[model samples]
Target: MTALPYRPCAGIMLIDRHGRAFVGQRMDSTLEAWQMPQGGIDPGEDPLAAATRELWEETGVASDMVEFIAAPDQEFFYDLPEDLIGKVWKGKWRGQRQRWFLFRFLGEDGDIDIATPHPEFRSWRWIDPAELPRLVVPFKRALYEAVLAAFRPYLNTQIGIEAVSQSDRPR
Candidate 1:
């Protein structure tokens, strides 16, 4: 029997003082949607460590500047593209089991630099939390919603007027 494949991953949701979150547009890809900075957990690396590394590698934010808020209790799954499925990584499963993190950005907006070597994102911007649902990939929307809900309490309390009256505003 073939062994089952499982890979661990980590992601960071960096929130700013204006109650906005950083979202990156994938570089060199046709799909133009945006998402949080994330990457696979290296062998023997803890989830938090991996999240910190990924945040810096992808967004140019120093690991020490952001405060960790929470980690998701569950993992998210998605299928890999068929063309590169087994060719890249030696795993039977194509997707990853991810642990997500929420962080408050302690640095200014000028600190971000997506143009570093081997850049993961082509561009990034501070976007309103309410706009995340429409900008993220559909399959990952639920997980993003859950992560946002989990970190809601720690997010900056100064919400905009529009978000206040909406009953369905993310927690």
Candidate 2:
């Protein structure tokens, strides 16, 4: 496992107006693990495009329904547990190297429909950003923590005494 390359991937942390992040339970998993939208970055594909594509594939949230926020200047990585190293992803990769994006969901809940043509989630909901790590599988806790740390500033900020809206964000 140590010798295998990490799979390239993109992850999305969709934020609601209340500063919560979207998470979903994997359809095939028996564990109580819930995770943010993420999936492999196809060969030669831009990570941002992959994030947008994966968002629709997993949660039925289209790019137009969300506004791009921030992405870490660096990538995050996590390795599969020993038992999973040789069994997942055709044993080709040891883990994933992810470029995570934060996007503000612009539409109402009705705009999201997880029952896609190729659904990856069983159920989904918005969660407090601070609770992310505890909700995910143990192996991904660190990655989630790092993501929170990186995106914390933008989640909600006070420039003085006023709250900024999406319109105030730079183009």
Candidate 3:
């Protein structure tokens, strides 16, 4: 049998003011599954643009609410499990080859509206970047880890931490 090709995709890491990453509970999963925004890239679409579009479609976050931060030098890839190889995506693809982005969320929590025209998530929340791998499906754990690694430098910066006035700090 011929090997199946990978689907071109884009992934998003939406980081809020508190330095937490957005995670959504997939409407299609029965397990305690959660993941960041991701989707197949449209034909002839730019990967970065596709990432912005996916972020909005899946999370209801508008472009104004996000600022693009950075992406890894290399895209990440993952394979579907044997049982799912021929069931998902019409079996046209074996897995996804994803280009990921780190976007800083500039809007308030109320800005998020998951009831998109085609909602992929049932619910969502912000999570620590370190916990992303544990939150996703086992098959995609490595992918999540790589994403975290790629964004590690940004995660450590003061980008997501809430600031306090000097008076508010413990003296």
Candidate 4:
């Protein structure tokens, strides 16, 4: 069989004032499937704009409350496990090719309301970037790792703190 094409998508790494990344637990998941806010890029939409829109859709954090940090030099791609190949995204996609952006959250915690017009996550929290790759579902781990690496330099820039290694969790 021919390989399915990857869906074009954008991902957000929303960081709070403390430099912790935002992760959400999927409502459809039975396991601890936490992930950064992400979604498909609409036709003719810019990836960074899609990232901002996805953040609002998934976290209720508006574009005004966030500032762009940086994007990876290249998009990262991930394939779903064989069991999921023909079951997800209406089987139109093998997985996703994502353009990731880091955004610094400027609003207070009260500004976030995950109960958007359409909700995807059941619960959400701020986590250390190093914990991100471990918390995400297994198939998406490498993607998260690449995101972490790409966004590591800017994690402390907004907070004006010492830089943290992408692979090292804070003590």
Go through the candidates in order and give each one's C-alpha lDDT.
Answer: 0.74, 0.87, 0.86, 0.84
Per-residue lDDT over 1-171 for candidate 4, one digit per residue giving the tens place of the 0 to 100 score: 147899999998888878888899998889989999999999999887888889999999999998766776688999998898888888899889999877778999899898988999999998888899899999999999888887776766445334434544211
Residue 139 deviation, candidate 2, in Å? 0.4
Would you give me the overall lDDT of model 4?
0.84
Evaluated at residue 128, the lDDT of candidate 1 is 78
How well is each residue in 53-151 modelled by candidate 3, as lDDT tens digits? 998899889888887777776889999988987788988998899989888899999999999999999999998889999999999999999989877
Tens digit per residue, CA lDDT, model 2, 1-171: 799999999999998877878899999899999999999999989898999999999888889998887777699999999999878899999999999888888889888888999888899998888899999999999999999998887776322112336554322
Q: Whose lDDT is higher: candidate 2's or candidate 4's?
A: 2
Greater TM-score among 2 and 4 belongs to 2
Off by over 4 Å in 3: 157-171
Better of 3 and 4 by lDDT: 3
- Model 1 misplacement above 4 A: 1-4, 81-92, 156-171
Kindly report which residue pairs in candidate 2 clash with one another: none
What does each candidate score in C-alpha RMSD? 6.2, 3.5, 7.2, 5.8
User: Which candidate would rank higher by lDDT, 1 or 4?
Assistant: 4
TM-scores of the candidates in the order shown: 0.79, 0.91, 0.91, 0.90
